[model samples]
Target: MVAKNQTVVTEFLLLGFGDLHDLKFLLFAFLLIIYVMALTGNALVIVLVMIGQNLRSPMYFFLSQLSLSEFLFTSNILPGMLWLTLAGGGKISIIRCFSQFYLLAVCTVTQCLLLTIMSFDRYVAICKPLHYTIIMTFGLQLQIVTLCWSTGFILSIVLFGFLYRLEFCGPDTINHFYCDIGPVLELSCSDISSTKLVTSMLSTPLVVCPFVLITATYISIFNTILKISSSIRRQKAFSTCSSHLTVVCLYFGSLASIYIFSPKIGSNTKKNLSLIYILVTPIFNPLIYSLRNQDIRGAITKYIHLIGTWQLP
Candidate 1:
C-alpha cells in the first residue's frame, strides 16, 4: 500500500544528538576530548605492548589485540559523529553509511571473540599452569588472533550482504548518531523478516555464544582459584583477571541493554547506552590494564625512564 508511493532513498539524514542547538558547541568539545582520550589510551596500550620485551606474553598479546580492536572500533564511529554534532546533523551517502556499518560490525564481533579467547588464556594460566606455555604458544596465539579477525570480517560480509539486498525507500532519517543494525534495518522498505532472522542467527554466534563461553571459562577459573592452597597465589590469580572482568562486565552490560532492552526504552536512552561501550569502555580499557597490571605499570615506568634519558635532537 504505502510502500508503493515510497521513493528510493540514496542518502540518509543522521539525527545525531538531535536538536542540541544551544549546547552543540559544548557537546562537540566534550566528545572531541573523549575521542582523543580514547585513541590515545588504546594506542598507548598497543605501543607499550609492542616495545616492552618484558611484557611479551599471551596475556599482553591478547591485551594488545583488544586495544587494537578498540582503536578501530572508536575510529570507525567517532569522527563522523563529531562532525554531525558540530554541524547540527548531516547527510551521509548510502555507500559511506553501509561501509561504516560494516567496519563497526567487524570490530564489535572481533572484540567479543578476542575477549573470549583472552578469558581462555587466563583459564589455562590459572587452571592448568603446567600446560599454559605449551598450550598458548606464540604460534597458537597468532592463529587465534588471526581466526578472531578473519571470522569477524567474514561474518560482517555475510550480514552486509543481507542488508545490501534491502531497499531503503523514503524515511531516510536514522534516529541514532550511527549506522547500527537496528536503526538501519528500520529504514528498509523491503520485507525484513528474513533479514531479522538471519541477523538473530548471526548474533547468537557473535554475541551470545562468546558471552556464554566467557562465563563458563570464568566460572572454571574461579573454581580453580578457590582450590589454590596459597592466599598469595589466589590473590595474584584474581588480580590477573580483574581488569578483564571489569571490561567484560562493561562490554556485555552495555551490549545486552541495547539489544535486549532498547524496545522498552527511548531512543535517547539507547543512544546514551551506546556511548558506554563505544566511548567509555575503550577509554577505560587501557586505564584499567595500566593501573591494575603490574607488568604494564613496570613497562610504562621503564619506557618513561628511557624517554627521560634520551638526548634531544
Candidate 2:
C-alpha cells in the first residue's frame, strides 16, 4: 500500500449559478431572504401541528414530519451554497464531501417517500372512508414513516460507497451548486461505468416507483370525488387535495426533470432544473399548502394577531 504517491484534492470550487457573476451579491441577498422565510415557515408548520389539538390527525402528523425534513434539508445545502457565492471558493474535505452527499441523498429520498406516503394517506381517507381508520392506524402510520427514512439512508450509503472508490485526477471544479453525485462522479479518473450504471438503476426505484404510486393514488382519489352525489362534498374534497396535489406536482416534476433525466441532459440544464427542487420547492411548500388550507390560514391569522397584540406594560 506504500507505493501510492497521489496528491489528494483538498477543496472544490462549486460553479453553482456561475454564469451570473454580476448578480452574485444580489442573488445571495435574495436567496438569503428566501432561506429565512422557508426555515421560519416550515418550522411554524411543525410547531402548529405538534401543539394544536385539532391537528392530531395522521395527515397533519405526517405534514409535521415533512416540515421537519424540509427544514433540515434546506439548512444542509443553502448555507454552503451561500458561502460559495460570497467567498468565490468553498472547500470540503474528502470525508466531509462523502458525508454531505450521503446526508443530502437520505434527506432528498426521504422527502420523496414522505410525499408519496402522505398522498396515500389522503387517498385512503377520501376514497375509502369506511376503512380509513383501520387501514391507517397509528402503528401503521409510524411504520410507514419509519420505513421511508430508513430506506432513504440505506440507499444513500450504498450509492455513496461506490462513489467513494473512484479516483479524481483533476478538474476539481464541481459543475453545479452543491456536492451532487453526478458532477463529482464526472471528476473521477477511475473506471466508474459500473458505479454510474448502478446509480442510475438505484435512483429509478426511489424516483419513478414513488411517482407512479402517487399518480395512481390521485387517480383513485379524483374518481371517488367525481362519484360523490353532493357538489359540496366534491368541492370539499378538491379543496383539500388541490393544495397537496399542487405541491406533489411541483416537487415530483422538478425532481424527475433533474435527477431522473440528468442522464439525457448535460450539467447546465440539470443545474437549472435542480434549482426548482432544491432552492424553489422548499419556498413553495408552505405557500401552496398553508395559504389555501382554511384551517392553516386561521391558525396563521391568529398567530399574527396574538403576536401583534402582545406588548409590555
Candidate 3:
C-alpha cells in the first residue's frame, strides 16, 4: 500500500541554492568546515564531560546530553546537505523524509525538555541550594532524560506518522535543503488542516512552553540572587546559567519567529531562519558553553598543553 500510494512521489528534489553555480563550491567548503567544526567541537564537549572528573556535575551531565543530540542532528542533515550541494541538487526518498522527521523530532523534543530541565536545575541550585542535591539526584536526572526522548518519539509518531499517510500527488519538490516539516507539508497533496493543527500542538511545547519555563526560571533566579549575601556566590551562579541562557534565547527567539509567520513567508526567509539553528546553533553552542565555563576552558588548555608536550617528544 505504501509503495503504490507513494508511487506518485519517488523522491523529493531539494531546491537549495538553485542559482548558485558560481558559489556552490564556496558554499560547499563553508558548510563542510562548519560540519566538521560542529562534530569535533561537540564531540570534544562530550569527551571532556566524560573524561574530566572536574566536570562531573549535574550541569555538565545535562550539557553532555545536549552535545550528544546536537552531534546526531548535525550528522544527519549536514553531511546530506554537503553531498547534495556537491551533486548540484538531490532528492530524498519519501521513507527517508519520514525518517528524518522522526529522528529530528526525537532530538528536538529531547533538547526542549533538557533545556527546561536545565532551567529547573538552575532554579533549584539558586533558589533552594540546601535541597539541590536531593532534588536533582542521579535517578531523577535519568528519568528526565528518558522522558524527553520518549515524549519526542511519541509525538513524532503522531506527527510524521500521519505525514507518511498523506498523499503527494503533485509538485514533489522540497524547496529547502532537508526534510523540514514546513517544506514537506507544503509539498503534500492531501488536505493539511490536521497537519497544520498537529504541527501547532507539537511545536507549542517545544517552542513556547520551554521558552516560558526558561524565561520564568531566569526571572526568578534573578529575583532570588538580589537577596543573596555573598557577591562571589551570586556571580558564580549567574555565570553558570549565562551560557544556557544565550543558547536558549538564540534558539527560541528565531524558532518562534519562523513558526509564528510560516508558509505565508517566502522560501528565502524560511531558509535564512533555518540557518540560525541548523548551521549557527551547533557552531555557537560550543563557543558559548566552553568559553564561558571555567572548568571546560581549563580542560581545553590542558588538552592543548598535553598535546604540545607529546608532540615535541
Candidate 4:
C-alpha cells in the first residue's frame, strides 16, 4: 500500500492566531483565564447539582450532564490552544490532531443531543405539568443521557475512521488553531468528496434535526405559557425556559455562524467566531443559570454556609 515516490506528512503546523504576531503573550494570557473560569464554572454546576438537595430535579440533573459535557469539551481544546498561542503556533502530530478532532466531535454531538433532550424536558414540564413526573422519571433521564453520549461516540468513531484513512502527502499546514474537519480535510491528498458528503449527511440529523425539534418544542412551550391568563404564572413559566433558551441561542448561533455559513467568511473571522462556542459559551452557562435561577442561587448560598459551618474550630 505504500507509495515509494510519495512523502506522507506525519505532523502539521497550526498557524494559530499568528497574524497578531506582537500579541501572542496577551492572547495566551486571555485564553488561560478563560480556560480556568470555564472549568471552575462548569465544575461548580456539576457539584451543585450533585450535592444540593434542592437541585435533585430532572432539570438540574440534565444541567449537570450538560456541565460535564462542557467541561470535557473545553478541556479538550483550550490547553492545546493555549500552547499554540503561547508558542506562536506549533506542530501537532497527525495522531494528536485526529484524536483532538475526534474528542471535539464527540462532545459537540453529545451536547447537541443533550440540549435537544433538555428542550423536550422543558416542553413536557410546561406543556404536560401533571404528567411531568410520570414521564421524565429517573430511569428515563439516565437512559436519555446514556443514549446521547453513546450516539455521539458512535457517530464520531465513523468520522474518525474516515479521517484516519485520508492520506496527507505533503504541505500539511493547517490554517487554523485546531484540527477542525474543514481545515484537516483541506490538507488531505485523497479524494474527500465522499467524506464531505458523509459528514454532511451525519451532521444534518445531529445539528439540524435537533435544532428543529428545539424550535418546535419552544414554540409549544411559549404557546402553553401564553395560554396562562395569570401574569405572575406566565412570568414564572417563562423564567424556567429563559436560561436554556439563552444557551441554545448562543451555542447554535456560534455553531451555525462557523460551520453553516463559514464558506463566505474569512479564515481569521472564522477563528474568532469559533471562540464564542469554544470559550465563551462554557463561561456563560453557569453565570446565566446561577444568576437567573433562584434554585441555583439558593443552593450556592446554602452550600457556602454549610462549608463555613464545617470550617469552625
The C-alpha lDDT values of all candidates are 0.90, 0.83, 0.85, 0.91
Best candidate (score: lDDT): 4
Alpha-carbon TM-score of each model against the true structure: 0.96, 0.93, 0.94, 0.97
Q: For model 3, what is the alpha-carbon lDDT of residue 260? A: 65
- The Cα RMSD of model 2 versus the native structure comes to 2.0
Determine which window of 10 residues in candidate 4 has minimal summed lDDT: 1-10
lDDT of 3 by residue, 1-313 (tens): 2345455776889877676887899999999999999999999999999989798878888999988888988898898888878877788898998898788777888888888988998899999999989888899888988887788789888987779778786688877888888888887778888988988877876898899888999999999987888999889988988999999988777777777666678888888888876898888888899889999999999988988888542
* Per-residue lDDT of model 4, residues 214-287, tens digit only: 99999999999999999999999999999999999999888888888888989888898998878899999889
Q: Which pairs clash in model 1?
A: none
- Candidate 2 Cα outliers beyond 4 Å, as residue runs: 1-6, 19-22, 309-313
Give me the candidate number with maximum TM-score.
4
Provide the clashing-pair count of each candidate structure: 0, 0, 0, 0
Runs of candidate 3 exceeding 4 Å displacement: 1-7, 311-313
